[model samples]
Target: MSTETDVDGGDTGDSLTLALAQLHVDAGEVEANVERALAAVSRAADRGADLVALPELFNVGYFAFDLYARNAEPFGGETFTRLREAAADHGIAVLAGSIVEDLAATESVETPAADGFSNTAALFDADGERRLVYRKHHLFGYESAESELLVPGETLETATIGGMTVGVTTCYDLRFPELYRRLVDAGAELILVPSAWPYPRIEHWQTLSRARAIENQAYVATINGSGEFEEATLLGRSSVYDPWGVPLASSGDEATLITTEIDPRTVVDVRDEFPALRDRRR
Candidate 1:
């Protein structure tokens, strides 16, 4: 559980290889979901990906509200341990996306409120050490019961990944520019957004992601789930946007893998050239 502040890991002499796993998860099927995540990690590693990121709440399908309480586990429970092992075995970092976390089972951090459940995301380094734990700050209330069933996170988390300062935000948080600003202020060069975005919001998803990258002059990887639940069908246009708002890699509505090579120096270059972030008034 090492925490890296504004320390830049710098460009590790090579372009960082990133893989986004847009997979389908069965509602309430923890074992099957874990297996799918692990398989994705293995496949990413086999393709020489330095890091792999999974979709939001891939363990317990996002739309499965009833299963959230039933299948919720602690931070270091089966889900965390298995992903850590997978990262170690494959020699690749993993972003084990948002999970239905049982707050009563863990003691390291204080709960956001008294509610015993949270949507948490865990990041494991290539060496298999847990680096960051991020709970979703913005919970969806419109057309969803997330806000009613879970507690919203109170803190922001960041860490160094693939020689670049990286930060995280969940699905609903994409609409908030201030959160992304906080990450930029923290010297984050890249932002990973694990989302469970549903239909009719594809334009919003792509626009917000690219806007964050362009304004902050940093890379943004938005990994989304590619499955259909009883309530809604997730629009899986998982993608990676460069500092200039260019699409590095993108996927359609399918369970697939998206890869891209990101240069940490690009952040610096974009900021220096555009200077939009530097010229911020507020």
Candidate 2:
């Protein structure tokens, strides 16, 4: 009775069904936000999503700068535990990241700051296994306190799932092409970006995401939140771009799920046909 079906109904054994859980995050409301995210996960699984990505700081909405310290969690904290369990129960991979991680309070992992908090993302496979942890390498300093409050991460790593190598990067990191290049070099075929991009910068979001996909020859998915903060409102234009920079699936300014199918071989095919990555001198 499982609703899961292979992407495109082809036994390609390569295509992956991805879902973007674009939730309307309410600032300072941890329980309410987590409940919504859990509901979205169930919905995505019912729609046959093999992987569902939650937005950055979905637990404690990104713009809630004053509440960050109050909600900072450890490596295997409650919010992550619930999502991990949901991943296992529903048989879907979950990218539960960009939480305010209490680095000094975590266990069984090496923290970058040792005594501070960080914007961290964790990838959990369908089996509820921790695949990789990506800390937001770039902290936004544009009239924001993110850079002043949290510690930047130094780890750059990738994990494997659905016959493809997956890499992770958070918001603000999108502005740096070099990071994408590094991920490409590390054999990443699918890169997940969890963001809280605000309004008026829609053009920057679209252009940067597509450019990363085009240049890296990899599938790039940007999962953004939807909600208004005291000083800003999220853009909520979550999208998935193929290796050729074409948007396979997208959404507008709303709390919704954007799902799409991407074949790993498409990456192989595109990179083979274009041969642009081969021309890189840097």
Candidate 3:
């Protein structure tokens, strides 16, 4: 459990109570999985979470490669509208895990492809305003059809919310440190990774997440999915890390919520004290 209090004179927005929804995403079951995610939002809000995040491709499970096209929704379509409504309803921000977005039908933002699909995530504020959108940049090619089936995104967006500069990334983006460096350079204080990592890569998950936080001196929260698929089982290890690379809260291979308080001041203090960021040979 996490408690929330003002870090600064009762009016400081520096503190944020965050929750990670490690959900059991059923393959091709968009309705069921989204309901679960929405329920998790309500649960997190009830427990006093300022923001709650879901895993990558949460509505349509990650390993269900064949179902991406069938379930692909346009940006700001039904799935995201519900999440936006949920955010306003609960008065909490939402990091809607990556969704299969139909680029051709989406008229809101610029698309990477004329009529292809992309893996995208959206952040909605407490007032139900769409804050930021991040499309998965580094698509996984190793033993995965993600690279073949979806068009890669080029947008790197961040939003100012919860007293922090929040940035979003997807699962395979974890392997690319340059992306994180770009985020840090863009004034990101907290990076949320909505991942759908599968089995036999526990060490890779933890290490990559922790390393991103450690190197950037920023908060890193990896929101992973749960449940088994036909060919792979999602390794549910949703976690939150501090600026010092400390695990603030985490969950195992189960459908659970990990809630805890995070502060922007902590990131500021750590960077000011250690100043490892200055050591870079840039």
Candidate 4:
């Protein structure tokens, strides 16, 4: 990984090599999933990737609702501890995808005790330090029972990785433009989406991801899972996009690693050339 001074020398613009781990997570298999994630991280670091992003609910299957209560862990618990070790071992920043977390519910909430899990994502630095925790704010309810099992997140977070300000959101959050707008206002130059978006909605997944990049004029990289669940199937078209909404790399419905080099300066250049963001009234 290159230093901040080596890229553009000052922090106005920088470059980073990002790896999208389009993995296939096993349902209810935590140990196996951790091994797969660790192997992917090692491969990404060997390829000179500075930051590695994984798919949503990577430690367990996304649609495995029957196992949520049994698999859920508290924040900063054992699951995150393993991820932190993996990040440090690879000497690369890691986006630990999304996990099911058990958070204490307020008395007024009245949600069921078994249904008090938070769909959360964790980030770790090269030294295995916890950097950020982002819980999914938008809960999808058409085909699944996410709302019944997971609580919505209240805050949006932005962090610095490899000298670039990066924002985070989960699967359904991609459909909400307001979230990306808020991240842009927070000075996010790149947005990372970890998702478990399934098949038959691949078009929506691809289109929304590109739209976020185009509207925000920032780098957008989405990592998705690849496998068949009990009643649904993941599409796993993990991709990376440039500031001009051009695709840098995309994966198929298979377990693979997608890598791309991004220049943060290009975002500034494109925004300057187009000036579309300045024309927004609302």
Candidate 5:
């Protein structure tokens, strides 16, 4: 187990490496997308990444709203099963990004509805076991049908991995700080935000990500897709931020892998030095 030092020169014991797969996704191309995703994971594992994260709705394009219902599948369906196998084979954990979940066939842990759909994220452990699932709570309604087609999630999910507590949240949820606060209160030292955010909002994406890390004093890894859809082109500035709001790694619009070392102890050190979280008032 090799290790790396943090920004402050602290020894990062049991440091975890991450590979953010910024892949170009074609709408309605599930088979090709899955193969790309699996290949990314394998490459990450070859580089000794402890975990790999994909962007939101990579299976079915985020802008391909018309194909949602058709592509929607139950949790642990073929896509998820293959990803789970990939995780097991690669000997790494995977954050299989947002899927167009069939709400009728799926039973959400927080918000259980009889019918409709959801933007969901699934986490698989290195052992190929399902660890956590998070449905998107904040749906984009400004210029989209997300709010109309999907019901918002009602629960916050966290998992213990690589000597840290990691929380899960989707794309639009990044804009809401209150949700992140809840995650912090739930003992989340790191948060994975799988996003499908398009162009014209690059500033918002970067700003909000740093804000979340700064305010919570935690690691915020925002993994975004690098593809363009018929309706929009995704801003592929996928980034990873440390507790001090430093951009550890970032990517441009091309589909590529961005790897970084994350020290679980850095979160504690930053909170001790800054102590903003402790000073928060009601």
Candidate 6:
């Protein structure tokens, strides 16, 4: 797409309207899940959203560990192709959340199998061009063995969309503040978090998301799934927070699309007014 820089060394009035697709995805149903995400995108576009963000592992439910090998697709495979088409069709940037990616194990001699998987997030610009791919760097290990099944990401990535510099992270990455700091260092004005966060930790999800926005002084939009799996139930509380840690729009335990208007200027205004980031010691 266009290589013009919008957020950096540009007018602060630039803003973006975002839609968080809190979809209810069924485990192992790729087609149905893709259709659901497409419907959400259409709705978001109709509402004048500049970009849409889907939940982590949206095509296949999070707890479906056994299905990772069976449902995995390569980086430029069908899942990403469909997302690119949808982004072009809707004329909006699409953050097609995390997917189980089958990376040729030969690429990494440490894990030689010819078939390994990674939890990767794919971003497609409005022109249907693949922009960035961010694999989940920090895999959760509380009760799940995601680290064992998925390869950790190597680099952080950011992109320009709707006149805003945006950074992306998958489910468990929200807990790490350093990652967010790195994104901000890369001139990110907005952060998109795609998660399949489970229940009994709703408070943590909300608290951490708000904390990230407050600390980074950037707009944070988190999209989570809503459904029950054989092993866990997803806590669907997708939300968007402003730079000042204000909840612009949020969702409850249901399959719904949460939309919010984010002004990139607000990040500048909040940081200028509060100057929190400037006073950081580390």
Among the numbered candidates, top lDDT falls to 2
Per-model TM-score on C-alpha atoms: 0.93, 0.94, 0.94, 0.90, 0.93, 0.91
Task: Residues 1-282, candidate 6: write the lDDT tens digits.
Answer: 101111111222345778888888888988988888888888878877789999999998789998988888877778878888989998988999888888882233222233568888888888898777788889888889788888788788789988789999887898899999999999999999999999899889999999999999999988898888898999888888888888888887788877667898888889999998899887
User: Candidate 6: lDDT of 129?
Assistant: 81
Best by TM-score: 2
**Candidate 1 versus the native: TM-score?**
0.93
lDDT of 3 at 61: 92
Q: Count the backbone clashes (under 3 Å) in each candidate.
A: 0, 1, 0, 0, 0, 0
Q: lDDT per residue, candidate 5, 170-276, as tens digits?
A: 99898889999999999999999998999998899999999999999999999988777778889888888999999888888778788888998899999999898
Q: Candidate 3 lDDT, tens digit per residue, 1-282? A: 212111111223448888888888889999988999899899888988889999999999999999999999999789999999999999999999989999988985445556799999999999999999888999998989999999888879889988889999999999999999999999999999999999999999999999999999999999998889898998888888888888887877878888888889988899999999988998
Q: lDDT tens string, model 1, 1-282?
A: 111111112233468988898887778888987888898899889878888999899998999998898889888888988999999988999999889899888766544455589999989999999888899999999999999999988888789987888899999999998999999999899899999999988899999999999888899999998777899999988888889999888888778887778999888888888898878897
> lDDT of all predictions, in order shown?
0.86, 0.89, 0.88, 0.84, 0.86, 0.83
- Work out candidate 1's RMSD over C-alphas: 6.2
**Distance from true location, Cα of 203 in model 6, Å:** 0.9
lDDT of 4 by residue, 203-253 (tens): 999999999999999999999987788879899888888888888888778
Q: Model 3: residues >4 Å from true position, as ranges? A: 1-14, 110-113
State, as a TM-score between 0 and 1, how close model 6 is to the true structure.
0.91
Q: Where does model 1 exceed 4 Å of error?
A: 1-13, 109-115
- Total backbone collisions, model 1: 0
Q: Output the better candidate (3/5) by lDDT.
A: 3
Question: Per-residue lDDT for 178-264 in model 2, tens only?
Answer: 999999999999999999999999999999999999999999999999899998999988888999999888888788887778899
